[model samples]
Target: MEKVLSKKRLQIPQVVAALKHRNFRLFWGGQCISLIGTWMQNVAQSWLVLELTRSAFWLGVVSTFQFLPMTLFSLYAGTLIDRFPKKKMLIFTQAGLMTLAFILAVDTWMHTVKLWHVLILAVLLGVMNTFDMPARQAFMIELVGEADLMNAIVLNSSIFNAARVVGPSVSGLVIAKLGIALCFLINAVSFLPVITGIWLIRLPKPVQPASRRCQEGIWQGIKAGLDFVRKTPGIFVPLALLAVINVFAFNFNVLVPLYAKNVFHAGAKTYGFLMGANGFGAIIGSVILAIRSAHGPKMRSLFIAAAGVSIFELLLVPAKSYTLAYLLLGITGLWVITFTTNCNSLLQVQSPPNMRGRVMSIYTLVFGGLVPLGSFLSGSMAHAWGAPAALGLGALISLAFTVALVIWRPSLLKQEISFKWQD
Candidate 1:
């Protein structure tokens, strides 16, 4: 175990090799721009939905709409990734996303936007993301080659967290002045960098198979992904942890508006500030991971991070006052980013290039798709128990999940979670 773990550790620095490549920079830059915008829209969309509906139930519902498609659509998207140029696919998705954002802005600006309109846009966005996410996940290799894949993943997290910091702060300011419509418009603009990045970067051809293999369709890919997960508990365990934790504790996004409106008595700007503060913690967490001295692929770091998520979630539940809740949530966001980023890093590390897209699609499905159902349960439970009790219960569930991971995956605890080709 130690020898295998040691070998895996050494692979960590190999991903840093991406910085040496110029094309990778273009791709990274574009991703950073788009991600920031995506975060901006995220903050804006949640609040807007809350404002329009003023119902926490629907907030969970809208969140569900966005992710449910990924659960349903990701397998097919992964299959398509095997069939198409990832870069071109991303371009189409990005363009579709930007156009949708613009249409939302136009609708809102014209005072024609309704709750149903938002739901429609949200669902369409999910469709765009289903294709965009897996392709983007796979395309990172073309930018930097495989040696620096780990670094690219880490750096991507850094950019994402950095955007989390920037997007909400700016979006909050914009929302205070302009409203959610303008925030959507800004999000549309963010897509430009990614589009440009696609236009500029040189990509390597995918290792072609002699023949296409498709014994089934979306369910087939989904079953394949689940089968992969079942065989690799190192991967599936964390995924189950994510799903269980999210069902109880991850409703913070759904709850944020309540925290702001009912608890804090604040408006759009305050909501943005709350999100931005959380982003600060996320930024700090990502930077720590990016610069962690742990040599090799230190994915055991994720187990630690998952533990942090469990702890911080408990912190948020009994928060006596609104300020206390805000602080706990900000810290929770930090831990949240830490765990997910590490999970992604580990998933990418252990997966083979041939099955990478499908594996990651499964990862995405577990991470995001499962969450909507979780949110619904959390919201319903909260609706019954009151907010704090619901949140506390959720936190406890997450903690239990992390504890199970530590017990079941002793290999992960040792930071030895890799599967190499036995040549």
Candidate 2:
């Protein structure tokens, strides 16, 4: 752990001071608050579904509902992002999420929450994210210019992982005491930081329009993004690995409580502790990346990390003790995020900016689109082969992906990432 912290060799921008941008600082602070709330809602919402029905199938169904909007709206949303001001679009998203959080809180507090409400809110949130994810991603470069691209990416991961740490543990306490509604309320409060940040940002004037190209139509843009991916097997190859991990290891968000109840015979607090451990590891990984992420000579360490995740995923499956499970889950979070954040940085550096919006939309597509499938498969797999076996298979697939990527993009291993400033 200490060595990982010290191994800072990746070429960060000389302008390590991008965080000094008043607007970027505001954005970062607000996003950190808001993302923590998002994680809280995720944990609370899943637990609420299980509480209402105690059925994993219902759990899978609700998860599916949440992600359906992303599948339906993502491509068009990316096109809209290209055409509009991302700052204004994100303000809308943040405000809308706050509204959804308030409704969820009220429903839970009143004890009137039902499975349908969960599904409704989940889908609505997904719809909001369809626009939100793309806009926010494109917005990152604008925040600090291309000079701070790596910093912004690492910092983004930091905000998310930080919230992951605080949100779940706190939500556990909130859910156990005031009920899940409190978790929702806390999440609503979380959005305030981001809203304030957005209000504070002084964006550069919008770029002059490129006359709409032949690919300006929404479906046409979608096709273009797809074509780009098909031709650049390099991008898709690494991307597919992340997608599989999300379905199997990343989707573990929906499975922790199941693990708590069935495997460890623990309650909400215990489950919260498990989540916090994972978050802790995730934060550490993000910080390490932020500090010394490689500019070139892509590390062979990613392959090793992929293999470690499989082992950790397997270790958590049948563990009888919470202590043992926490250790495994922490390791699981660390390696998986390390692998993912590194891949995103590499892909971002390698991709052309003209097509960045579309390339990123494809990133969102696989990232979110695969979840519903994973949620269903994981739930069903847990139902049949047992939780441990299902997760083990996922780990195995991840290992296979790592091996294939190394073989296919051996040049990826030789190329060093370099940062260039944009006017």
Candidate 3:
């Protein structure tokens, strides 16, 4: 009995294995708290935009303003991330984000919140995020090294989805009782734990300064990153697929709110619950990946997940009831995290350590930078037809793209990834 118990205790699940690293544990805990507030703000912001404008086009415009900086400057931001210490840069970005949240909260509280105020603040928030996203992605490797890199990435996604599960649901209740201002205020305060966690992290060794070649010039660095992606088939293929999927299939921010109002004839609480349902599915998906972290990322799984997202999204077209929509969105959420998490791991594992930041910047660029265009497309489509039609069209486009990729490169499904780059 004693021997059996000892053996069982030694078998820690792969899902939580990344937390064994002290720095990663701190970072994970902090993010878990912070992301919930972020989601609350996200839910409130979308609903707030609708309350102010009641136009899907205007909602897209606000989203466009928020992500425009990333579209324009993410490549340049990547160079900066490569040239600096990620932790310090992250601290600065977090503080900037916190300040913006506070400003928005104050404006909303004072009833001086105009659409323009939200737009301008969103632009500032985008500026902060262009730097923060890639830095954060690149920093994961440093926290746990290559041995636990996949575990760390999946763990990060798990917490993010977990927050998605908690944040919007709670935000619905908060928004119903308090107001949208409180959500922003809570988000502003939530930054403290993450900032403190990053500050407390002690890397095993000092990170090296950027190579002279990397510091040559911002334009040159951007060119190099792009050139590298163009040449690497493994990295390039996933990115291309992600770009298509991101532009069409991932406009839930714009569509979900509209669905709640225009389709379901429901209000804020229903919208929050819908968003929460999607997050719940995402949490389940992340848990599945966490359990299978030992397998790392696979090309076949990536394609399948991409296809799954489109298929599930397409099913939403026939959903007439809130329960059916919620169920479909949950399933869609599952496929989304699986596809994105695999793409992220594939990019990081494939790139040389020196180029990881730039590679991830490209990832951030497509994943987020393109949100403006996607949001605009979805919003315009929703305005012209309806939320369901817009969503159905995007899903159709995404499914077509996935099919085209497989036809174009039948070999991609069988390609085995090599983790040859030294950490």
Which candidate number has the best lDDT?
Answer: 3
lDDT of 2 by residue, 7-68 (tens): 53223343244585677888888887788889888889888887888876777778888888
Q: What does candidate 1's lDDT look like per residue over 69-168, in tens digits?
A: 9878777778777566777888899899999999988998898889999899988998888888878887776676555666677788778878877887
Tens-digit lDDT track for model 3 on 372-408?
Answer: 9999999999999999899999999999999998998
**Which parts of model 3 are misplaced by more than 4 Å?**
1-11, 205-207, 210-215
lDDT score of residue 371 within candidate 1: 68
Q: What is the lDDT of candidate 1?
A: 0.75
Ranking by lDDT: 3, 2, 1
Measured over all alpha carbons after superposition, the RMSD of each candidate to the real structure, in angstroms, is 4.6, 3.7, 1.9
Model 2 vs. true fold: TM = 0.91
Question: In model 3, what is the error at residue 194, expressed in angstroms?
Answer: 0.4
Regions of candidate 2 where Cα sits further than 4 Å from its true position: 1-16, 210-215, 294-302, 407-412, 418-423
- For model 1, the stretches where C-alpha displacement exceeds 4 angstroms are 1-17, 209-223, 320-323, 408-411, 418-423
Q: For every model shown, what is its TM-score relative to the native structure? A: 0.89, 0.91, 0.97
